[model samples]
Target chain A: MTPTDLRAAFIADLTAVAPDLDPAAIGDNDHMQDDLGLDSMDFLNLVSALHKRFGLPIPEADYPRLATAALAVAYLDQALAE
Target chain B: MSIFTMPSLGADMEEGKLVEWLVKPGDDVKKGDIVAVVETQKGAIEIEIFEAGQIGALLAEPGQTLPVGAPLARLGVADEAEVTDPVAAPEPAIQASRAAALPAPAPAPAAKPVAAAAPGDAVLASPAARARAAELGIALEAVTGSGPGGAVLLSDIENHVSAGPQPAAQPVAEDRPKGKPGLDMTEMRRAIAAAMSRSKREIPHYYLMHEIDLQSAHDRLTALNADRTPDRRLLMGAFLLHATVKSLAKVPELNGRYDVEPYAPSGQVHCGMAVAMRGGGLIAPAILEAQSKDPDEIMAAMRDLVARTRSGRLRNSEITRGTITISALGENGVDALIGVIYPPQVALVGFGAPRVRPMVHDGTIQPRLAVTVSLAADHRVSDGRRGALFLTEIDRLLQEPAIP
Candidate 1:
């Protein structure tokens, strides 16, 4: 899948968890938790959604790689490639 | 026959609309089965039955607004011999056929066959399990039962779903009516107003605040969550909740309800976590038997409670069983909040946002992570001194964070 598709998937999952989130306003570098105000539970939901969507194994250690939109999309892109 | 009445979900809720029924006549239901969804001031709550029985008749219709304790349904004895008897058999069979014939009734059974089968051959499953099975398109007969007398439970269905092939990425959003447009905030505001008004009118409240150094708690939490996944990680709120529960044990007078003239202190702590809903409203459902749970368990329970509360799928006991409430301001919220006690309960504990501040630690002034802990207790049940001790115990507990 293209980076654009991965970014769209990320936004869709994020908005599902935090319904009030403004998707268009989200910057690529904005921290999902700190800047976007997703709590631990909400962040977990987002990760679970991504895992369900892409069918990738997101280990606990690699959670830091998905911290930001840019980082998450890049991580997904690389994980999908390999 | 026993009547399943509309339960008082909270002190604030006086009436609720019977939004939908999950069970029909002739269906076998057990204690703790969610038979109906009632739209209260707090939103759509899945109403659980308190007895094991066969659903005999639905006394109320969908969309009919009824007061608390009004009969919602009639439950007949689950005994086969009793149901087979000529006297007991005909009424429910007739009702069963009538209910089955109703347009768009859930669990749409073949009208004649279910009535004929009544209490004997009907699948023994909780309404929640049935609903989930219907959602996932899993046949209930295919799933093995794990509950009492081989009843197919929600967990059993969940296990079945997980063990089988993955279904399409259909969000479980359909399980809840997302069309309600944010849980009727006007009704919630009214509920809050009534409860707060009653609380202020009846309970003589005494407020106390203590600034606790959260340096130890913060460090411990960071260390704990470093190797853990997002799902397994603990929040500072859990630590605050744990400390509050432990402190409640020390000051027992502040731990229970004051419903009648005499104050009754409970031996157990059902700590109510005040969670703000997504659209706009607040509901504090208790973490049942919080005394036995560690910080990790408390965090899990809090997460589950928050999710269910936001989804408007809370059980009746969760709303009614709170002994004391704990309200924590969000990360970006103000420094402190003096909360109104959710009455019948005598006390409220508030945790403000933790911030770095210069404090006198050991000898010299140093920057420490600190939070303000506030308590609003009923003056009738306990004095300001006991409240102070409760706050002090919480401070001590937080300073020496529990290993778990």
Candidate 2:
């Protein structure tokens, strides 16, 4: 998938975890947990959603790479490329 | 025949407004079936019936607020023929007939007074709608009503908020209000205040804290989840809950209710898990018969409970049947939290975030993932020694964490 598609997919999963979140309000560099207020369960759910969407095995060690929206899209894009 | 009353969802809940009836009269419903939805301070909880029967009559009308123990509906035996004559049944049956007959003519006139009342005097809105509006900081008068008799509903409030124009400027974190989105903070605060106040006033609580090394438990969980998917993976909180349940076996004194003068011990452990809602506040619902459940089962139950609690779909029994409560602050929480015992329940177990701290292991200092476990027990039921033993048992159980 293209970078734009990957970004959209990540945002869709993020919104699914936190329905009240507005896509426009989230900045690229904002931390998902610290800024967006996604708790541990919510973060797990977001990872689960991304895994389901991208069909990738995201190890727990790599959770830190997906801390921000831009970081998540970039990580997923690189993983997809691999 | 039986009457399903408006259940007290929590100790603080005295009354709940009938939101909607999921089952109509003549609908067959068995035990544990969600028959209706009631709007309480917590949120709109889907109320379930414990008896198997056919719905005979819906005694309470939608949007009507009724006190705890007030009859919401009548149920007749599933095999028995529907009784057409209202006089043949009990007193509530007659009242049910009047309720059924009055809906067509009564609502129009009855609703007028509530709608016509001075602004904010009595806004004709469901409890859920009022809560949503309050959370959004939207005045009820500004939002157009779309419900029955032009009543403002939750959907209308959501639509109003979303369709309206954005604010001229985004409020910074410091300027933003205290509450999180999607929860009725004021109502929840009031409910929490009442319950905590009552707990402090009535229950003589004794607090105890213990630090448990979670290196073994953490390693076991890691091994368990190494090949598993996110959906099936176990959380550390599940281990804490399982250990708490098992430890209750050793200290049975802490696993019951203190409702009456004489403390009664529960034969089974219905573990109450304190799940924090998305916005703010928390609810402690039980995983019934938790003694039979393993760590994986506890994890699954906790996930389901968290989802249901967030969505406000909790059952009456889940809300009321907890014998002991456990509150675990997840990885993001502080070092430890000393909790207040939920009334009637004798003990509450609290698990703070597990952090890697230096501890003496094998006669040498080593970094281990250790957690602070705190217990608040009713002094009337159990003393500090029993409470300490209970904590020690939990520490012992976690030392060699159960894999299955």
Candidate 3:
């Protein structure tokens, strides 16, 4: 898939995990915990979902970057760019 | 000469009875070889010698509970006698090998709970707690021992168990919730209170009090409770239980408890009993597989349940989830009062006021010992048609002369 497509897919997965947020509202700047009400377990589940969807290894150290929806999009964009 | 203090073993070991002496006076002693057997912590352990020397003095008396390390035996210097000691070379190597084999319990750096305890202030808790503390790999000194003389309690270990490196299930707050919002019974009860208020409020439940016609079931029950004692007896409650079991067997549909949560058909026959505790609140414990057990066995199980519930030993798994209930107030002057149908359990059968009441048998007024049986049925799953049928079956089982 194209980088943009993969990033959009990543955004779609995040929105599915956090269904309260409208798909249009989620972006790089939106934080999962504070902005989307995703707790630690939900955050871990999000990482697991991302790993399954993209087939990439996500280390615990990368948790900070994935905290925000914008950072998640960027990280997914970079991994797909690779 | 090393001043070897007694190694603090279990918390309960304030002092130990010297069980046996492995080495005699003037016997050459090795470091690892058990010099003596000290009975501490309600069990015996082989006390190893620290120094390779001559067994010069026997300080502790056998069968006397001496404080650990009260100088049971002394070792003289090698030059004092012609000591041909073969065990000396392996002692240092054995010490090193023991250190290498065992995981070193390095206490957290710069963190000590308090000053080391004196002999009088040492732990004396149960042996199990000491072994548990050891298994947690906790430093005894770091733990604020909470037993007698500041020794630790079992709860203290549990409370402090997760403070160190926890491998898994660390209450991530989001994963395993301690609790959730209480179920709001407003809407559900409004409809229930309406029906129940209407049932008691409207449907005139004609009073029909019957006595415990216990002629045939008694002989079998008497034979059952009678035997070489395991200490359980089949009383009137057991008779009631047997009757209820028989009643459920006669009417399979009556066995169902109210289950509206899943909105699926509930297919269980759990009988709930109302136990009046010393305190004010009332709780009904459900008996599963009531039909399968005989009167004696049912009474035995019921006694255990009563004892467990009264002593606060009943597990949450016991009562938190059940299929049905048989809440009774037979001793409490209640003659089959109207019972509230507890949610999810389809029926709550309350037994009450077991006494003699005059009844007309073939135009002859005769006084017969009768008991009031109240059944509260979930209206959503069943109506008065099925409810009456269920009650008739229960009445039949209680009054029947024979049950196979």
Candidate 4:
């Protein structure tokens, strides 16, 4: 899948995890916590969602790389390529 | 036959709207089975049946809002003997069916509320009243009786909990963060206001705080998570829950509710963790029997509870029967919290954000990861010394990270 498709999928997963967030308003560079207002608990859930959708375990160390939509797409691309 | 009434979800819930019934007539249900889902101010909660029986008929229709204790269904005995004579059995069955077909009637009006009696040594009190008084650290001599025959009621004990904290409600309201628009938070706020104000006005609370060094636990958690994936990784909350339950075993008074009568120490620990909802408001549901689970199991339960609660689905037992409660502010928020004791409960434990701070051990100062732990306990049931011991036990238990 293209990077754009991956980003859309990631945002879809995020929206599923946090129903309060508006999908249209979410920007590519928006941080999940600061901008979208996901609490630590919600943030953990987002991570869990990503793990489930990709069928791969996400390392805790890689959490920082997936902070924003753009960054999450980039991280997913690299992880998927490897 | 037994009438299944709506169960009380919490102290704040007045009534619930029956959205759907998971069972129908002639369905046999065991105790603890979710029979229906009711939507309340909190959210959709799956109502469970406490008796094993076959549902004879549903009295309440879907989408109907019913008050607490209003009968929703009629249940027939599960193990009733089958009639052998076909002719005789059909007659009895027809009669029984007629009886069950009748609509449920409105509950009888409650007895008139008696006015509080005058205060004196002659004041009569319920066993629960005396127990609540002992739990709140209040002397019953000053409280006026409100029950029949000039007996003191449990409400009286709560009403006499503290002398002056009652005045802080106004200022606290002024300082509360305003709710975002479009999300109906008024009812939620009012429920919170009533419960917290009642807690402050009635429970004689004594506060105790201790700083715990979490460096060892932190390192151990990191080591445990190093090779694990995000889905399998355990959150710090699981450790806190495990430690809290273990400590309650040592300090039995910290567990159990105080109302009507002082119950013996709970046989199992139902540790309630406060979960903040997305729109507004909070609910503390338990991870039942936390003492029996390891950290990993606790984490799984915690995740499931939060997810289900946020998704507007919870079980009946989750909202009630909490022996103790824990409120953790995670890693970003406040330094410490002196939470109000949720009523009927004897104690509440709080955990502030875990941060790195300078520490002195063996005469050398070094930066260490630490968190502030605070306990707001009913002064009537346990003293500050016992509360301190409870916190100390948590600190000691966390260091070893052993779950047997």
Candidate 3 residue spans exceeding 4 A from truth = A1-82, B1-232, B249-262
Candidate 4 lDDT tens digits, B336-366: 9889888888899999988899999668998
- Report the C-alpha lDDT of model 3 over A10-35, residue by residue, as the tens digit: 77777555443567866667777666
CAPRI class of candidate 1? incorrect
Best by DockQ: 4
Candidate 1 clash total?
Answer: 0
**What is the total number of backbone clashes in candidate 4?**
7
User: Which segments of candidate 1 are over 4 A away from where they belong?
Assistant: A20-40, A47-82, B77-182
Clashing residue pairs, candidate 1? none
Q: How big is the positional error of residue B136 in model 4, measured in Å on the Cα after superposition?
A: 45
Write the residue-wise lDDT of candidate 3 on B1-404 in tens digits. 22223443332234455655656545666665567665432124456665676664344445555554343443553444322222122234323444555453233223233221211223454455566665654434334556787676666667667575322112212232111111112322333354345445433333322344443354554455454222433455667766766665544554553333444433555566665432223445556666677766776677656644433233322443455567665433646765765445556566775666776655888765566676666655555666666566666765555542
> Which regions of candidate 4 fall more than 4 Å away from where they truly are?
B81-184, B401-404
lDDT of 2 by residue, B1-404 (tens): 55577788887887787877777666779889998888777767878888797776566676667777666766666655443323222335434545564442111111111111122224579888887765664546556689997799999888987887422122222343333332456777788899899999999999999899999989988888889877777788888899899999998999988877688889999899887765667878899999999888888888788767765477778778899999988887799999999988989999898899999999999999999999999999899999999999988988873455
Flag regions of model 2 displaced more than 4 Å: B78-81, B85-183
- Which tens-of-lDDT digit does each residue in B1-404 have in candidate 1? 45567788877776778877888766778898989888777768888888897775566666667766555665665553222222222244434555556653334233332232232124578888877765664545446689997898999988987887422122222244432343766777789999999999998999999999989888888778776655577778888898899888889999898876677899999999998765556889899999999998998898889777755488777888899999998565678989899998999999888889899999989999999989999998899999999999988888784555
Give the per-residue Cα lDDT of candidate 1 at B298: 94
Q: Please, what are the lDDT tens digits per residue for candidate 4 over residues A1-82?
A: 7999998889898988777677899998998877777776678888888898887677777888889999999989988888
